[model samples]
Target: MSKPKAVVIYSGGMDSFTLLNRVINENYDVYALTFNYGQKHVKEVEVASTVCQTLGVAHKILDISPINQLMQSSSLVGNIEVPEGHYEDDNMKSTVVPNRNMILLSLAIGYAVDIEASKVYYGAHAGDHAIYPDCRPEFVNAMNDVAKIANYEPISIETPYLNSSKGEILKDGLTMNLSYEHTWTCYNGRAKACGKCGACVERLEAFSENQVTDPIEYE
Candidate 1:
């Protein structure tokens, strides 16, 4: 029998990129699903496409403008300022989109059902909990229950990094042989990481904690 297939909700961010690598390491037939949710970083969509292509996996990009319209708290969606500094700091709250994980998981579940996949991988991690409540293990478990009930064939949601810090995620990615250089996690929507944005701060901290050098360019 062929290995069961899995779909990864990739966004070309560090965590999602690492999650994609983890799914691939499991040796399941992997497919990548990206969303164009009117984010400031449309470049992430392109990066996600390229990452999927490089991994030789099937990829899909969904138009989720309605979802984008529903989110305004996040600087990523509207004319809001991208906060600077560490994600764990108070300034990072500006980036928290309301119900982002709920929306993403709901859409991913629909796509997983359509694609006949039983497992969906997401990159919600401990590092996100300071700003994103939906990234927590409780929310993930709740969403998994929803997916199980919603899908005719039943499905499982995997968040391998749920309890792991960003540093741990980066280390796991290395073990999975991921090419981190191509992934982008900047909230500034620039060609290089702004280095001052919360996402950039987190990425840098993760690498530093791991005692590893991050290969991505930053300005």
Candidate 2:
């Protein structure tokens, strides 16, 4: 019997990389979809490519750089400096690319349909919900509903880490022996990760909680 197919929205971040491995481990014929939306962390696209090549998964990168022009309020794409702090800090809200997940999910779901995949998987975790409305559980539920209605064949959005924290995600990834070093989570897109950014801080804390040293370099 053939395994069911899934299209994963991969970002080359720790969470999404873990999701990719989990999907493959669960026996899904994995397809990775990455979006290049002109975010400050554009280096993640290169990282995504490396991961997909290493994992031998079919990967596609869609250029949606125009969205950056429209959502200039986000520090991810605008001239604003990327905030540095814990994920819970209010300043981190500036990193929220408006409706980012929704836009990505819409494209991913359509790609899933085109490829006849049964599901679209994204790595939105509880840690992000405080700052990103689109990462909330309610948003996932609603997006699943939209996918069901939008697809001719039965298709849905799957967010396994919707309620899981960054720490838990790291633990799971460690169990799978994922190559964390290749993943990029810095918002500044620097040569080395800006260890002070919200993304870097959360990732560091997660690895610490798991009692594992992160393989990535930091400055």
Candidate 3:
């Protein structure tokens, strides 16, 4: 019998990349699904492709640029200036695209059903719940139910970060021998990570908390 196919919503960030290895290590056939949802950081998508390629997993980068126009109010889209400082600040909420995760996961679930994949994975950590409502455990559970009913199948949405912190995820990934240096976590659309951006600050903190220095270059 073939192994169960799992589609991961990978963004080449710490959490998603960790989730990718977690699923792969579990012996599931992994497929990485990346979305270009008009975020200021296009580097994440490029990094996602690299990560998937390195893992020898099937990968696809879906164009969801239209959603960017619809979500123009978000700081992540359009010409809005990327916010600097910590991820826990109220200013970071400005970057949240309304129902962005729902939209992405919905699309991934649809694709999973089309491909007969058994599980869909998303990286939603506890720290993100303060800024993103859709990243909450309740939201993920609700979406799982909705997707299962919408597809009329037993498909499931997995949130490995539901009970984990960003620091824990970095530690887990490091323990698994996962490569963190190539993963991009900047909110700015730049060649090198702007160390002041909210995402960059968060990533730095995670590595710091884990007592490990992040290998990625930052400016």
Candidate 4:
């Protein structure tokens, strides 16, 4: 019997990298889908390509640049600077790309259905719910419903880390010997991660909580 197929909504960030490994570990014939939505985190697209190559998985980069035009308010799409602080800080809301997960998941589900994949996996965790509304549990559930209704085949959204903390997710990835250094999390889209951005701050804190130093470089 063949292994089940899973489509991973990969962003080449710590959380999604961990989720990608988890899906691979579970023996899924994985396909990685990444989006180039003209966000400031363009480096993540390159990182995603590298990570997928390292894992020997088929990867696709979808162009959703129209999102940049639709959601111009976000620091990710506009000249507004990405806020620097902890994930829990309210100012981090500036980084929210409006309905980002919704758009990504919709496209992912369509791809998954075309490929006859049974599941689509994403890495929405508790750590993101504060600022990213689309990462919240309710949004995931609603999107899952939409996927079910939209597809003729049985397809579902799988968010195993939906309620898990970033530390817990990282620990699982570490157990699988996944490399964290290849992942990019900074919103600044620079050569080196700005250590003060909300993404950097949260990732550092997760590593601290896990008692492991992050292998990624930060400026």
Which model scores highest in TM-score? 2
TM-score of each: 0.95, 0.98, 0.97, 0.97
- Candidate with better lDDT, 1 vs 4: 4
Candidate 1 error regions (>4 Å)? none
Question: Candidate 3's residue-wise lDDT over 1-219, tens digit each?
Answer: 999898999988878989999999999988899999878788899989987887799999998887787887788886778788787898888888878898898889888988899899999998787888999988998988887788677789999779788998888898998778878888887878899977888888898998888988877
Model 4 lDDT per residue over 1-219, tens place: 998899999998999999998898899999999999998889999999998998799999998887698888899888888888998898888888888888888889889999989899999999988888998999999888888888688689999999999889998888898779899999988989999999898899889998988998888
Ranking of predictions according to lDDT: 2, 4, 3, 1
Off by over 4 Å in 3: none
Error of 3 at 196 (Å): 1.3
lDDT of 2 by residue, 1-219 (tens): 988899999998999999999999999999999999999899999999999998899999999998799999999999999988998999999999988999999999889889889899999999998989999988999888888988677688999999999999988988897768899999989899989999999989998898889888888
Question: Which consecutive 10 residues in model 3 have the weakest lDDT in total?
Answer: 78-87
Model 2: residue 53 alpha-carbon error in angstroms: 0.6
**lDDT tens per residue, model 1, 60-170:** 999886777778878988789898888888878888878877888888888888888999999999988888889988899888998899857788999988999999999
Q: Is candidate 2 or candidate 3 better by TM-score?
A: 2
Question: What is the lDDT of every predicted structure here?
Answer: 0.86, 0.92, 0.87, 0.91
Candidate 3 residue-wise lDDT at 28: 93
Candidate 3: residue pairs that collide: none
Q: Pick the candidate with the highest lDDT.
A: 2
lDDT of 4 at 104: 88
Report residue 22 deviation for candidate 3 (angstroms): 0.6
